[model samples]
Target: MVEAKTHLATKPRWLTPVLFSTTIFLSASLLFFVQPLFTKIVLPHVGGAPAVWTTAMLFFQTVLIGGYLYAHLITRYLSVRAQIALHLTLWALALFFLPLAVSAGWSYDAEQSTAGQTLLLFAAGVGLPFAVLSANAPLIQTWYARTGGYSADDPYFLYGASNLGSLIALLGFPLVAEPLFGATQIGWGWTVGFWALGALLLASGLMARGRHVRTVAQTQTQSAPSLKTRLLWALIAFVPSSMMLAVTTKLTTDIGSVPLIWVIPLALFLLTFVMVFTNRPVASMATLRLGYLIGLGVLAVVFSNLLGIHVSVWSAVLTVVAFFLTALYAHALLYSERPSAEHLTTFYVTMSVGGAFGGFFNSIIAPSLFNELHEGAITVAVAAILLLIRAVRPSRTALFGALALVVVILAKTTLISTFGIFVFGAIAIVLFLAVATTIRHTEHALAWVIVGFLVAGQVFVNHGTPLLRDRSFFGTHKIVEQDGLRIYGNGTTTHGAQRIVDLTADRPEPQLYYHRNGPMAQVLTSAKADASGTVGIVGLGIGALACYGQPHQDWHFYEIDALVSDIAHDPSHFTFMSRCAPDAPTHLGDARMVLAEQDGLSFDILVIDAYSSDSVPVHLTTVEAFEIYLEHLNDDGVLVFHISNRYYDISRPLGRLAETLGLEARIQDYTGNTAADPGDVGSRVVVLSRHSEGLGDLNADPRWTPLASDGGRVWTDDFANVLEVLNR
Candidate 1:
């Protein structure tokens, strides 16, 4: 042993850490990069709902648990040589399944659960390679722990390097890889990266071979951890894992469900891991606790809408920052509780189990149990309780004061309306600060107050008692009755509305985006001459567009969510479909997929208005998608795109598509005075045709103008960058 140590000491100092770090880094980079890439590939088929990403996250987390388990079992039971041979064989087997692409046989099935379908698709496409890659972080770290090097006693720092690689990959995907490379190119590059990782793994294994026997004996001498400690590890890991998905879903629900939105929260999550796992953390524990409390307060205010701040961009930034602070603090606590290097693989296994449970809860359990998007609020409450468990007890005065404030705020119903919202907001802020200052030294008191605020906010603020609330794999839908109108809402966007007094009237007027003076009505008017022919509409929001259909027209509706279809057909909730076009057929699946199945069908006019909240589905706007639309249109038929959005300039990309196909395109940006009719809000619509004469007489009207295609990139299914077209 002395001679072996002498021989090992003769080698260079930095080689082992660098070798293991590089191997672990490459593995982590590939692991994270493939998540968004593969999910993006399968997104269009799944209807482009934000829930798709959440479901995909559940699948990946479950697979990560398997990978961590594999690492623990192999490192504990097998000899170093056996472990190396086994892992390498697994890598080699995974290669045959690489250069990842969805199989030709796979397609979305409406009969089955969408989440189940998404899981199966991921399992078939990238499961093997991802599982193999996931093992490298823990597996390589275990090898490093046994290498008998100077730093072998504590190998956790390498985890920082691993997460750094993950952060880089996530950040690089939207900014660099996604813009410059297609899916095929990314797949091939990833395959080459896999080859490189394999070589590095082999080199790393050989270096650790000689010392493993001795280190195994040494590790056996150390005391194993208690069950309580293992459970603690899991609970600490669960909060941030669940919070990451919650924040992602919140952002993507309103913003576009593109790779950029998905990557931001995940990148921040990994960055926290990188920050906390280092020998010297970026923030001290004192600083972390304070920041975390501040973050919770900010999030509570935002979620409750206490101040009525409606700027989407600022709201998004604040939520993201709050998430970052909470995750950073949670991970720092997790790091502080980590076990010794001897039990490192076991530690990681428990953490992965926790992460898997978090994903399972958010993706599967929450959607079934809750009517609203309450996961974010619930996670925050849980995090505060767990994180402040060690805080000192508060004084009786402070506790009583907090309770008194909570009671007063909950009972301030008419007081708020009488004094105005801003005055109420100011008074609430002052009361919270006074109580928080009294219990400055006792974090537990602060936590309880925050929890009370969250409970009160969830119960009294932000949302109303809807006439009906429904949730599914797509999103949350609420039918609300307010201002003497029955409104259908999905996420933050209003889908359709109708006056309650009009329920008994025949052919009730369409409201919201389909109002009489809105762009949708103008498009339908332009195609009035072709009313006797077939008309196909993509989105079936309360079947509002059904009222615009003429009696002799063959009207067909395509809607992805079955819940929306049910709501639209229910006369109790919405009478548009029953009264206007009672016989119109509604297809229950993704618009593009169902349209592709229509072999000999063609429409005289096609309207594409599919949106999840204010977000337009990217798949519907891609070049390949337009080709399908064109194929289904008559020579003189027009394609109408409802491009109204608060965050993105979608019309630019559509214009670029028109220019690429040499098709005539015109746009209408209609802004009606809402004071005249609340439903007559602003809308941006673009119309495309194969010829100039196809636009009809209204094409000569001054309300419509040629589309501006400047600085726009024609998006294809293989490539799109939403970052470029953001509304500055």
Candidate 2:
């Protein structure tokens, strides 16, 4: 009995490590959960632009730097008890701003900068709480390091636990929390979680009472990291941070800007941290080489639009894979270069600084500097260069041979469009040479070669320059003349097109989805006889529907992006808006908000044609938004939704909303001969009204079928699940 009691007393208490881990986990969960929840709440206010997420990422990163700075300072200078007191005080103070919500008075203005406005809103809403939560990972890990408990000497593993919590929260919000709870409910739930985390923190501090206090003499004896090491840490961190945001923009711009898409990239990012910091087996050199090859393939697809692979499931998967590999590689390097636990806070502070700079570059610098959405491609190029720099070493003879081969390929692909696959072949050869070369070091030569190839590909891949390439808070817009037609493009999708030959015509024909043979024309033509009242359009895509207006009717356009509005008004780009509806007034703001504010204005025909690329602004399709539309429509007014998309089957959800509202609806899937006239592409439109007579001939036409609900969930402003309507 004496021997057993002694063994039991000597046995380590398991509670300390578990206690600290749990505290870090809960704090991380709260931090990530609020990101999507609050961003989703702010999305509609900012026109539901995907850039809103990019801007929010910037804000979060900047605040994370602040949090890490605080941690670094307190851990370096203060006593353990002092640090605990200060942090606990901060936790308590953050509670005053809880039950996270945006201010009711705030609203986005088109004339104001979007990034600035979004930053201000986030700062006002959840900034303090997020900062407090951000500090926990580094702070708790430092405390654990000083506790002299299990694995305390190497406390970086605790970082893995923090990221594991982050991963769970990010994935759960989209897959579970968001689907199950509304925004308000999620906010309140997060507040409760925050309180629980505080209690755990207090308990953790009490457990480590007097045990974690460090002597000034002990601190002075520890060596600090050199400037070069600190800079390397920041650079290694910056690559993945920038790449994450860039890939997110690419995904959200192509697919719908929903929480599911938002979470996938971020989850993968956190997963990388979890893997690297937990001492999980990383990819081998051979595996990394394979990843480089895949990265090149991704570049081939992105730069050249190879195989017409724009916005498809496989394309998205490939992009995500490339991103994952790049982030894993960069973060593994970061882990390999980690400082000892004594300098933990300083290490994290540098990492946060790098991440903040990356966010700033992607969110602020890139957009302002480049005319197109080139940040993704640019980051990919940088990643390629960095990987090559790390992996490549060449002899003088090999370097000379590579330079000679590049010259030959450049000559052969001077007319790149004609060479077809040769361009990608050249890119592959250059990258392969960079990888296969062996010597002491030739990273600079390899980097320059990669950059040269990328620049050449970027310059030569485009067959012709755009007439106008403009970017706004909403997205990138391009006007190009192709196939005897002038086209307006947003991302990978064509917004509108007009026949160049029809420039002399008094009223040029509407093209693309608005072609005379399409459902848009059919509906307008059918309603023309009695529809002399106001005509309201939600999207001003080159104002293609403007020609449908009669002299007796009044036309108004609601366009969210001011840049798009400016382009539509410029006759040099497209003559559709200038010639068709030169006098029509265009409202600049989100369609839902603007429409709700239109006091007594009613429309005989209301067209919601605002979908850009394949991205759906979910807020506009909700039941509440439909009610708002109904408020602005005449008793028998017809409502039209342009549902043409390559990635989503949203008609079912709209049909569900129509069923819930007890409205009559019909859909027309119009197929046109684009082979003969590029402007006459296919279109799908859904028309709804309070009465069947409002649909006129469309109700009886065989081409127009009754819209099917198929029992999908009715989306509301409070809740929406994009996964439900995703096209398989």
Candidate 3:
């Protein structure tokens, strides 16, 4: 399309490439870095809900699409000089919003809505800066292509460079910036970096000045993409972009809602782009084909827990890997189908549009429409189908689609009920087989039929599934029954459970963390609230603790997620609240924010059970949080912390905090016998109180052990090291 510029003997070929690449790299990296930083700043105020990050991703993707659209319009319509002037002016205007920080004194209230508040915070703090930064990759590549440089004809390698920077920034921030600096300090550094990026972009603009482009040559030789090609580009981009968010939700739903967890899937997502867009791809076509097959298999295991089968923690790791590989394939396909440099901005704009749709569907729309995370399964199934079409011939595509459908059906059938899960799974498998046969026999007349059959099968199986499912902004909540045990699932992990036939003498039996033999029962029996004493509980899960409330003890539950509160209070989901404490009013929003509004010593006992289904809301576990709990409790009140977690050992930190305040702390690590009811699962509780002598029988009990003090360590509001507590 252009004369490939051969540098003279004196002129270095690498100089222009370095300058252009630096601008692109810095822009992309800074854009990715700010996402976690801004989201982290907003997390505590919003009550550390997982939905906060998901929704933030939706906003970021939308802004990104806007930036790409701007780039496309300017590049298509404006002269080279005009484009540079407009971008520089916008960059300078964006600089007016420097040192991004969430506006102070904004926290969710009873009157406040979570989704709107998050949007407000983002807009007030970092929206302009993010939008401006998002334009850099597309615009800079266009500029570089016009520079008459060695890499001009094929400036797409610059896209890979930009993505590499993004991946590094994502992986580095949690490991470096977050640990080393406070939120305010991180913003200052980010501001400095942004200005530096602006300077580099200015330099790139100066270097890329041009009076002519080979338009006549391009028109004569290269054909512009048709409308069909553009739409195909958008669809390809949609799958992985949406799937990334879906898998991220999957990860955080299982692991805690921390920045580190949020960044992993995203970093891998960026890494795939880096690989595929490069001159040499990290995963070749053959590699992608094999990896996708493995990814499809891993997708099967993720569904196993939904079907009531035991899931290894390994499954989560495999799922992450699968998403990475499948994404590599998707982006690789995009790279293969890339258009000429003249259509560069248009190509990116189409891809960004697809990405925005994916983000909206998974982050915003899916939570409201479907009760459970059918999106993840749907994404995987559709990806397998589409990717199969790309990887092999029509005959092979249908065959693989049939096999994948069968695999999903088989996974669903592991629940294997009489007229329920098994029957639906069998029907689905047969339907897919028929579809596959039809494709072979009927010359692709009914390929779209596979989509309908697959979707219908999923809906019916989901409908027939035994678990009582509810969708909330926080995550999917499911009450699943097997044998005599009813368990509460947050994602795939069981957070709490109860027995159907009461094995305990009590009418309302406490199961899982609240079992009679469990530490909760021991403490409730010991720290009985007085006639006027108020009991404060954080984290409402199935309202299980209501069974232990002393009559007329003035119980007030502080719940962050409103949806969780509804499910707990509703009789259909669990009767603990309705049967035990029907009139116990709940305080909604973040537990910290709700408590901050209260007068100190408003309760006799404060129980912290916010760690549910692996979602350890870190803000709720910090030293500042402990102080708030103490202030809310009466002089001799008991502070109970449910510290059971799959990865984080929070006991050490909790013990340290108790020691700091000179409060007496005891930990009960309960393990029930084999003959005990399955619902009465074991638990660990850290009990802290100022006056243990006033703690009734708990003071003199031989079973209770004084906390083995931690290594003088604590997580504060300004500082937290979640990675240090890895169970490994």
TM-score of every model versus the real structure: 0.93, 0.92, 0.87
| Residue 121 in model 3: lDDT | 80
Candidate 1 has an lDDT of: 0.82
Off by over 4 Å in 1: 211-214, 305-311, 391-444, 462-464, 527-532
- The true-versus-predicted C-alpha distance at residue 634 of model 1, in Å, is 1.1
Q: What C-alpha lDDT, on a 0 to 100 scale, does residue 196 get in candidate 3? A: 92
**Per-residue CA lDDT of candidate 2, range 1-728, in tens?**
56544543463668778999999999898889889999998887876778888899999999999999998899778877888899999999999988887788887786788789889999998888999999988989888776556877678999989999999999999999877878888888888999899889888776655433333345443589999889878877887788888878877888978888988989999998998786664665445444443454454345444323255676577667767876776776778778778788899999999988889988999889987767766766666566444433334544455445433443453423346457657666765576456444455545555566656666665557888887877888888888888888887788888889877778899888999889898888875425547999999988888888888888899998888889889887777778878999999988898888779899989999999788877989889899999999888889999999888987988899989999998898888897877778898999999989877777888999999688967888778888778787
**Alpha-carbon deviation at 61 in model 1, angstroms:** 0.8
lDDT digits (tens) for residues 232-334 of candidate 1: 8898889889989988888888887888999999999999999999889998776676556556655665555453323276668777887898789888888
Worst 10 residues of 2 by lDDT: 409-418
Q: Output the number of the lDDT-best candidate.
A: 1
Ranking by lDDT: 1, 2, 3
Clashes of 3: 0
State the C-alpha lDDT per candidate.
Answer: 0.82, 0.79, 0.74
Q: Over 4 Å off in model 3, which ranges?
A: 1-11, 109-113, 210-223, 283-287, 300-311, 387-467, 485-487, 495-507, 527-532, 690-699
Decide which is better by lDDT, 1 or 2.
1
